[model samples]
Target: MQKPEPMKDQVPWATIGLVLLWYGTNIGVLLLNKYLLSNYGFKYPVFLTMCHMTACSLLSYAAIAFMKVVPMQSIKSKRQFLKISALSAVFCFSVVLGNVSLRFLPVSFNQAIGATTPFFTAVFAYLMSNKREAWLTYATLVPVVAGVIIASRSEPSFHLFGFIMCVSATAARAFKSVLQGILLSSEGEKLNSMNLLMYMAPIAVVILLPATLLMEENVIGNTIALARNDIKIVWYLLFNSSLAYFVNLTNFLVTKRTSALTLQVLGNAKGAVAVVVSILIFKNPVSIIGMIGYLFTVMGVVLYSEAKKRYG
Candidate 1:
């Protein structure tokens, strides 16, 4: 009998489809967020973020409980609930600041600043866990930081406060990722991303409610007024909030289907695609230096991913 031939790996169409869906939801939510905050005069980032959390809370519950998409995990202890609350608080901060930055900065420029997340992630990992990356991995971040500085100077519509908000938001996001690992490192405490969101969203909504009411001036009344003038604003909020949940869902799905490193690589490309698409949609002006800087930052991110893959 002839020896059987070894089978070659086939294309993963299901994973590819999920990736495309991930890209669509991620970029769609981002563009819509920019539109609502800047062009549509929402003017209430905190409240908008609250709405997103509320939607996530409802949608995630339905997905887990009714749809039976994933096994629901319960909080085993008060300590775990507290950890989830802390993560939720951090999440609220990152999201609201991101929306506020979008109100002042062009989407393209905002994405450029957000690309520096890897630099912040590395810093937080070291500070929080005393963990260190290889020297080459650290070296990869230099261009990431430098590219943002170059882009900041060259950006046609640079806003100082916006830049600060964007950077702070990025840092907060990275901090949350690191803190999540530290807080939920144990096998018993570890929750899948979906269950984590399911538990965290309601806590985030609770946290945001008082902050939104206190920080924003007459946000509810103004939103009602806006909706009265154009009922489409109601529809827009519904759609935008729904997209926000989908963004989280798709992100979890993509990471489940592919490795985390693949997700990071896809994320770098997603940011670049978002930048190009936003510039075209919003007709934002970009200088050659700005484009070069954005590209340079993206290249650094790619190198950082590769370095992590190899060094780890």
Candidate 2:
């Protein structure tokens, strides 16, 4: 008898475990990030982002070169490395801006803003790939945009700085997705997430360190000394980096076992879960209109994902 296909015929227990791992880690990272950024008064987003990129680069190198968790696939030439560098530029901004946003906004509100990423994804895909969506798909963006507008208006603790940074981060993330598809459509250029992480994370470090130096007042050395003195800060920072790696790893695992659309759907669901958990943990004062608006945006994303599955 022929072996069953792994993607189509997943072992039920294994799939369930992976789903739980992905969900738990994704939520855990967000909360921890919020705590470190705002609640704990460790307000150095650029440096924190630098740390994450540094850890990601080191961990990814080990996975590709030493652990052999994924077969190593290095970029072939200068042109290819340049493309990866461009991708890294956007990714670095996305993460740093995202961390910056968490410093001012409640996590619930932040995730509500993030739920609009599919709207930006639709826009970026058209510009980058010249790939147009169906009229219905275009129409679906109305609710996503409108919901966010309403949610932002009613968010109890709205901060203009956080709002702007969150929106920028969402747009940057969408751009990264579209650009990666356009840049790596070739079979030879394709790298699994770990290998991609190995290359992109280091490039991001190169792009971010200068920005951290220019924008952040605290030197990297000073920050490290401070974190070392605080035992809890040290562990949280380390755990955060480890959690970041698991995030990328599980994203690859889920997409391989299931489909990209399934992962997208799960991402939407995760955003919703994160929002609810944030409200509970932070006791954020969300109004009824704000709640309704968030629900609308999330539902719109679900619809958008389904439409993409069919028409995209």
> How many pairs in model 2 have backbone atoms within 3 A of each other, for residues 3 or more apart or on separate chains, i.e. clashes?
0
Q: Choose the strongest candidate by lDDT.
A: 1
Task: Give the CA lDDT, 0 to 100, for residue 72 in model 1.
Answer: 88
RMSD (Å) of each candidate, 1 decimal: 2.0, 4.0
Per-residue lDDT, model 2, residue 210, is 88
Q: Which candidate is the best by TM-score?
A: 1
* Candidate 2: 10-residue stretch with minimal lDDT: 5-14
Q: Which digits, one per residue and each the tens of the lDDT, describe model 2 over residues 1-312?
A: 998867775568887788889988889989999999899888889888888898889988887788887788878988888888998999999999999999999999999999999899989988877889998888878889889999999998999999999999999999998999988888988877778888999888888888889988766676678767887888888999888888888888888888888898888888989998988998879999998999999889888887887887
lDDT of 1 at 116: 93
- Superposed by TM-score, candidate 2 places the C-alpha of residue 238 at a distance from the truth, in angstroms, of 0.9
Q: lDDT score, residue 20, model 2? A: 80
Compared with the true structure, what per-residue lDDT tens digits does model 1 show for residues 90-145? 99999999999999999999999999999999999999999999999999999999
CA lDDT, candidate 2, residue 158: 98
Q: For candidate 1, which ten residues in a row score worst on lDDT?
A: 36-45
